[model samples]
Target: MNALPNIVDSETGQGLPRYDLRVENHGPSDLEFEIWQIPYNGTPDVKKPLRISGLRGRNLALIEHRVLRLLAKAGIHLGGLNIQDQARYALNEDQALNLGLLFRTLAPMRNRENMPMVADGIEAMGKEEAAYWLGMAMHRKYPRRVLMALRFLLIDPKARMKD
Candidate 1:
């Protein structure tokens, strides 16, 4: 069975997730990319690890939106946690790391060359790139920290729960 590329610890030889991303010209100056979520041996640089080349796309809006909804839903499941803990957990570095990992698994997509979302005629995106845009959009609209996002999501997990 095929697996994503990852780096393993040199000492332990234990494999771990590692990302390899690239953005460059694909056609006549239009940008494209090659991205991988490697499950490599401890030392990716030193080890000749296998890699998986994920599909490329012009945008990740759909996947990101879906992921955010899913994340909020998962958090909502843990209703036992108080608001303070829930909000705090949302901002925790470890949570961010896990989210970062999740970002690598999404497939890429495309858009019209002149569409408002992306008129640049781009052809690819890294798994989490859409999440970056989503974050920026959220910040632009709300302009706050984790607790605010947490509160918003918890109050209505269905708010952003798009299919």
Candidate 2:
């Protein structure tokens, strides 16, 4: 396995920053994962962390939308304590740490981009439209925080059980 890259402070761009996880291939087989950088407070310096994990071979596009719905119902903020608690409850220690890192990176960028809800009335979304736009905005500004928020949101019982 290759040495994991050092987690850097997003704002100062300094080294020796502490992140939730530093992903590296543990096995000989090749693995693919996505990395998102989430910012906080609209400042490039105060980032959360990096999330690195293996995909479960599911349809991520669909999962992403479902997760958005969960977030909307939960009323959980990206970097809020509720989200952190949820991450702890839903994921294992390592997963939670990874998620925490991701949240730090993504939360700051939430809603930074403008994604119109309606465009020519062509039935723009099937589900979780608002969440999708929010995620997109998060991705543009802070990719990691958005993922962390989504991770917890998807597994949050209160968020999912709502009508």
Candidate 3:
């Protein structure tokens, strides 16, 4: 078994779904990412952690664009958020931290280049949504693996069943 590089551990006590992300570079063009979701209430099972893998960088970007377009079409007034030159929308300290961690985990190679502009688009995406898009992107090539990821995301046992 091979180990991944830059495996970021999740922060506890945030009451948010913890994200454990691992990014491994197989080559100049090939990369693999594994995201483990640690529910706030329980310990993550290491051996059976729900994994979303094989999402190409291009695909992830595509999903990001689609999401932005959809939001725009919905009349959300995202003008300030779409500013290309600078960060017109201020992210408080915590969102800034989340953005940095997510950007590094998702696109480590491009982390230093035009980060503020790129963050303009994805800064609104919560961690779980980012993970979901990543899983959907992987589903483009590997369908079966994404099923487990879907089940994990869609079914929250703690939520009470509606009548």
Can you write out model 1's per-residue Cα lDDT over 8-119, one digit (the tens) per residue? 4578776545544333333332333333334345445535522323223434434434434544754523234332231212222233333433232323212222122221
Candidate 3 overall lDDT versus native: 0.40
At residue 143, give the lDDT of candidate 3: 42
25 Cα displacement, candidate 2 (Å): 11
Screening candidate 3 with a backbone cut-off below 3 angstroms (N, C-alpha, C), the clashing residue pairs are: none
**lDDT by residue for model 3 over 1-163, one digit each (tens)?**
3332222335642333344443444445333333444333333443354443324465345344543353345342334322122222222223333333344334433433333333443455676665455546444586445434433344444532441
Cα-based lDDT for every prediction: 0.35, 0.34, 0.40
- Model 1 segments beyond 4 Å from truth? 1-19, 28-30, 36-49, 52-55, 60-103, 108-156, 160-163
Q: Tell me how candidate 2 scores on lDDT.
A: 0.34
Give candidate 3 regions above 4 Å deviation: 1-16, 39-47, 52-54, 57-121, 126-163
Give candidate 1's error at residue 114 in angstroms: 22
What does candidate 2's lDDT look like per residue over 16-60, in tens digits? 323222223323332122333334333357555444332212222
TM-score of each: 0.25, 0.19, 0.28
True-structure RMSD, every candidate = 18.4, 16.2, 15.2
User: Which scores better on lDDT, 1 or 2?
Assistant: 1
lDDT of 3 at 159: 39
lDDT accuracy of residue 20 in candidate 3: 44
